[model samples]
Target: MFRNGLEPWHLLVVLAVIILLFGSKKLPEMARGLGKSMRILKAETKAMREDDAPAADGTANSTAAEQDRPAVAPVTPATVTKADEATKTNTTA
Candidate 1:
């Protein structure tokens, strides 16, 4: 018989359970981290939206964004010679 789906006491019980599970001392740290994460997410979403918006001078934002980002070297598979493989095998053995 779940007539009153959620009352004030129900919320209090849930809060009590959370406090019991993650102690009172850790709650503030968790809350602070959550707040920081939310702020970062908001900022990233704003930046993405700005990047999507067209410039007034008809220039693409991609060029500017690309310039701001660091270039990473492309990863290529390493070619192992028989000598190298043999050295690895020797070391392991």
Candidate 2:
């Protein structure tokens, strides 16, 4: 009969068993990984919710168009090394 559900001592025993199985050193690393995964999941869900919300203009099609656009990285001027400049001059001749 499950009359009384999970007292403090029950949780303590569970914690003790986990510690024995995993040891104390690995627990922190596991907890840190779990925290990071939770944060990434939360961010992704928030982004999805935002994407699902209707725009102020009441246009749902605009969101799809925006997603279709390719992301472009900014272009920077290439730095020319002395060796590259010398090679260029040799090739031009």
Candidate 3:
């Protein structure tokens, strides 16, 4: 039967095991990679939220750099069908 759920010593044991398995140098590299991955994930999620927000409110929420760049048209099913038809006609001809 377990008397206590978790103790400081338990954490120390886990840390010791991790250090032994990964070594000191590898742990720093792993931690750095993890930090980068976390930052990238946070940025992507924020961008997704920003993208959804503009669509929902029908307002442009863009930077000056974005405004200066030419807008790319989104592909639609109708456009795909038209393109396919054009290709087919060209192939037949």
Candidate 4:
């Protein structure tokens, strides 16, 4: 495979083109824009990682004691049935 890199000659050509196209005065402005773009990208990437990390490592996040307990009490139909019966009885009567 072709080496994936800009040789010194390539870099020199690029720098010459940039300097010719944009005078030295404008080069500072171009560099400022590039730096701002990089900062924005870095912040967004970090935020994405933080969001994904919580979901990815959620299982490991629970406290040791919490992990030992059942997730929730079994939802027995009888408990709900009694409440519904009461509500219906009151509504009808």
Q: Runs in model 4 with CA error above 4 Å?
A: 1-10, 55-93
Best by lDDT: 1
Candidate 1 residue lDDT tens string, 1-93: 789999999999999999999999999999999999999999999998988898889986675768899989999999767988899999999
- Writing each residue's lDDT as its tens digit, candidate 3 over 1-92 gives 58896899999999999999999999999999999999999999998787656545566677557879997999776534588899999999
lDDT of 1 at 36: 100
Q: Is candidate 1 or candidate 4 better by TM-score?
A: 1
Q: How would you encode candidate 4's per-residue C-alpha lDDT over 57-85 as one tens digit per residue? A: 45544444776987796776663457878
In candidate 2, stretches whose alpha carbon ends up further than 4 angstroms from where it belongs are 62-93
How many clashes would you count in candidate 1?
0
Worst 10 residues of 1 by lDDT: 58-67
Could you estimate the TM-score for every candidate?
A: 0.64, 0.62, 0.58, 0.46
Per residue, candidate 2 scores C-alpha lDDT tens digits across 1-93 of: 678888899999999999999999999999999999999999999988988888888766457778899999999999767988899999999
Alpha-carbon runs more than 4 Å astray in model 3: 55-93
How well does candidate 4 match the true structure in TM-score terms? Answer: 0.46
How far does residue 18 in candidate 2 sit from its true spot (Å)?
0.3
TM-score of 3: 0.58
lDDT score of model 2?
A: 0.91
